[model samples]
Each structure stands twice: as C-alpha cells, then as structure tokens.
Target: MHEVVAVRATIPGMTTTVDPRTVFETSGADLDAARAVFEQAYEASGFLPERTERVFGYRFRTVGDQTMSFRSTRFDARMVGEVDSGDQVSVSWVTDGGGVLDVGRDELGLSPGRPVVFPTGRPYRFELADVRQSVVQLDRTFLERIAAEAYGTEPGTLVFDHTAAPGVEAVRAWNHQVQEASRIVLGNAPVSVLALADTARRTALALLTTFPHRITARQVPLPTGATGRVRSAVEYMHAAAHTPITTTDVAEHVGLSVRGLQQAFQRQIGVAPNALLRGIRLDRVRDELRAGTPTDTTVASVAVRWGFAHLGRFSAAYARRFLEYPRDTLHG
Candidate 1:
C-alpha cells in the first residue's frame, strides 16, 4: 500500500523547506496493487503493464516537492510496461538489472552510470528485468522556462532528443553534477534560497547541455549601425526590448562584463543599462496599451508581454515614466 506522508517541500528559490520525509513508500507482491502504486508514485495516468510476472519484491520511495523529486525504486520481477512520464521529465540510472525504453521509434537501453530522460511528451514503453534505479524527476515547466531565459528566448524551443550522453567523459560529468545537486537539495543542512535556486538552475542547464538537443546559439542583439559597446547595447534594448533579456544578457551581447557594462553606460549614457532597458520596455508597454483596446487586450497583459509581471509595481513605474498610469494611456 502507498504511505502518503505529509511533508512540506521547499519552493525553489523561495524561503521554504522540504521536510525530509517519504512522499510515497510501498512494497508488495500483488501485481495489481504494485501497478496502482506505480501509477500514483509517478503521477502517471496511462500505465498499461503487459506483464509483471513473479513480483518477488517491489519497493518505491520519493522525496521533494512539486519543483523536483528524488526517487528510489526497485522491482525484482520481469516487468514490462507502457508508461508515460506524466508530461514531466525524468532521468534514471539503472544500478542493477536492465531495461529498454521504446518511444515507438527508437529504443533507449538503460545502463549503469548513464542517465536518460524517458522519452516524454509522447507515448513510450519499457521492459525492466529485476531492476533497481535512482530517478530524478524535474518539473518540465520550471526547467523549460529557465532554459528559455538563459537563451533569451521564449520557452518550449529546446527539446532533449538524445537519451545518452555524448561520451564517457560527458557521462561522468553529468553524474557528478547530478550528485552534487542532489546533495545540496537532499542534504542535512538547510539551504539558502539563492543556493537552492542556483542548484536547480544549474541542474536544468546541465541536463540540457549533457544530453543531445537542438539548441541554436542566442543571437545576441547588436547593431551594425552602432559602433561602441554602449551604443550597441542601447540599440539592442530599443530593438528587442520586449524580449526576456536581462542586464547580464545585454552586457554579454555588447561584449562586456556586467560591471564593465554598467561603467560604460554611466560614462557614455549617464545611466545604467538596466535603467535604459526598463525605460524602453516601459515605453513599449505604453505604446502597446495606447494602441490596444480593453476588448482587444488588457493593460496588465500588455505590460506582462514586455516583462512587467507585478501590476502594482508596473503601474507605479509607468506613471513615473510617462506622467500617467498605464490604464489612463490605454483608455485615452
């Protein structure tokens, strides 16, 4: 039977804590009961087990919150099943026994020291023969958003296509990174919000980098019309101001460190790059609001499209910048 332990899991990058308690724990020989537990543990819906013959011992345990999960699973049986990853992403390394995951196109052979993302966002099947594995489940939504932000693009572009690492060296590196992140996240000492958030971010970045994926180089916006770094940065801010680009992103685009960019902007433009970016985005928001209608779109929606998430803060900034409120401009 499943033991639902009530333990709080810390929000990544938030002032919270994940109680080190089991989220799911069960061990039984009844195939039907085991199947039910499996489905519940993974939050998986479409689980069609073809055969789980002679289930000698099956144990499952997981910890962590909605952001991520660390799971230990052992099934001593000839288990063959069709399972989906609940539209989430999972990476697992087989410590004992073996399995093959088929995404209805290609197959992934589960081996030791090798972590693989179960071909998700689609139907997949697996056959495990008396296996024990450690699994890390990541919230696809959180991970993808981080990925997109890192690349200065919107989410859902990058896809983890290959299941295996590029080589042996890559495999070892991946294992080390995962283990380190696991230690910080599932460790004894309480972690800082910054530490936890960085851990999660690094893990997500490592996962995407280690596995084979189609990711294009970020077209760091710079203009041929501009000569100096500060000028180029200004041009970039004006051109793609609505993008999810950050000060650091702008700095790198203009070939300067964050501090260097700040210094340059102060020297040349008498203001920080961030200030200029915010002013540009604010102007873009105002322009959009003035052109848009309440029936067509709301002021908050227009503001969010330009990276203004908090309505209260955005309203204050808009008023300070444009001498009027965002809603006033829209209604005008």
Candidate 2:
C-alpha cells in the first residue's frame, strides 16, 4: 500500500491555501494545482519556495486496513525548489530513482535503501531524476535535542556527512523497512500506527547519532522509565550483529555520533567498538563450531558467514582471541 501524510496550515485572507494531504492523486492541471498546494504547504511550514514545474503525480493515504486515494503518473521530470528560513533539518529516505543532492556546499549522490539528512536553512538543490521518496522533516530544535541526548554533548554541534559508512548495507535495509512501515502507517493499519510512530521516533534518534562528532560528554540521557535510548541501540546491534553491521549505522540507529557511540559502548560494555564487533563475530563462530554439524564445513566458510572479509586475517584473529586455530576447531 502507498501512503503519504499531508499537514495543512491556513491563514485567513491569504493569497494561498495550504493543505498537506498524506495520500491523494491528481492529473492534468489538477496535478499542477496539487503541486501548488504543496508549495503552499512548504511556505506554511516556514520554507521559502522557488518556482516549481508541474508534472503528473499520484499520492495515497491510509489508516487501518483502509486506503484513501491512488493515481498513476507520467510527466517530464518535475522539480520543487525549497529553502527553510528557519533552518530545520530534514531526514529523508528515497524509495525510487537515484539523484544528486546538494546541501549547502556539499553534493552527494543518493540511492535507494539508505537514508540521508540535510539542513534546510541554506540553499540546496536536488535532481530527483524520476525519483520517488519517503521523507520526514524535523524541527532544528528537536534534532538538536535528540543529538545532544545521544552524544551527551552540546546541542547544535552535530554535523552530518552524507557519505556511506561501514554497515551501510544494514542501514539501507533498516531504512527500507521503516519506509514500508511508514506506508502502512499512512495507508490504513491502525494497529501499525503506534508501532510505526515508535519506529519513526527510533529511526530519527538513530539517524541523529550517525552524524560525525568528537566526544565531549561522558554520559548521555537515557529514555525515561526504561534503560533508555542507549540500551535500545545496544540491543539493536546485538540482535542484528550477524548481519553486516557498522558503528555509524548503529549510532544512527540510536542517534549518536561515531565518537559518542564509541564512548557509550566503552562505558557500558567495557570494550571498544572493533573489539565488540570482533567479539560478536567470534561468538557466532564459536556457536557454529560447537554445533557439531557435517564434517564438510570449512572454517573459512564459517568465518565468511560471520562477516570476516579476509580469511587469513580471520584465522589469525581467531587464534589470537580463542587460543585455538579455527582449523583446529573445524577439524576437532
């Protein structure tokens, strides 16, 4: 199911009417009219709008097992130019078509799977290139608060880099899952709304933590009435460690910078980042070693399966940590 969320802001006796429709469809001039409506929505959201061209487009909104409206589209590549005077940050994930995004002075290529974020106060440009996107915007203050919580550092100091990092593949997978959940939330699954909202909140928190920063604070705030965001992030990593994992991805999932993420892990787990990752990999290897499976199983296969990128290095590391060669375990 397809879904969109539209929020509206209206001013009496204004030249424009803003209606943010989550899921809706239009065609011909009507499509252009909807684009205009979106432009108004952007303006109402405190963004300065530039000229935008109209193209055929479709949108849908949902709530429970119900969907509202749907339409198909065919148009020359359409574009919308936007600037937020208030300097809000937007965290967005693309569902279709790759594009080049220019945020301030940096230009980055965006593709399907991974999520990207940009600050809105500056001039930015994007060529969607037949792109379909699932996006959400956060107020600058809110983003700062979340970042501060993750880093245990000063707010408004986190700087996001759009480049991919280790475990990026894992992040992409999670992002797609969030997009699907978003679709359900906007489509028609009341049962999913709360879950999706919680997911959205967690995703936002994680993305913030992925921003690059130096360590300054020793302890970050935790979620109230629970171990908090940091614990949730650790659990997420432990649960998904067998999958390709990266510190940045985990940090973003928990809303901390690489340094902050490292600091948190060291404080809570008593080990460094790579150490923990290696331990996780080794633990999985040990489990396989003890399973007593077929004799044809090779140590190299087990190493690769646990994400050892190099067989020789994996063997040496395994011997160093376990005091036994992987081959010895495989043969024994």
Reference-based lDDT, residue 162, model 2: 50
lDDT of 1 by residue, 1-332 (tens): 44445455554665545443335566766666777878776544455544445447678877665667788888877666565454367888889888788735588888876788777543466777778999887776687687788777766534567454567777777788888988976776655556766777777777776677654332343322332456557766775776799999888765468998898777766787788789888877877887888889798788888998999999999899989988889889
Q: Candidate 2 on 60-112: residue-level lDDT in tens? A: 22222111111223323445454432334455556665566774447777777
lDDT of 1: 0.71
All candidates' lDDT scores? 0.71, 0.53
**Pairs with backbone N, CA or C atoms under 3 Å apart (clashes), candidate 1:** none
Query: Which candidate should be chosen as best, given lDDT against the real structure?
Result: 1
Counting clashing residue pairs in each candidate, in order, gives 0, 25
TM-score of each: 0.56, 0.42
Error of 2 at 143 (Å): 2.7
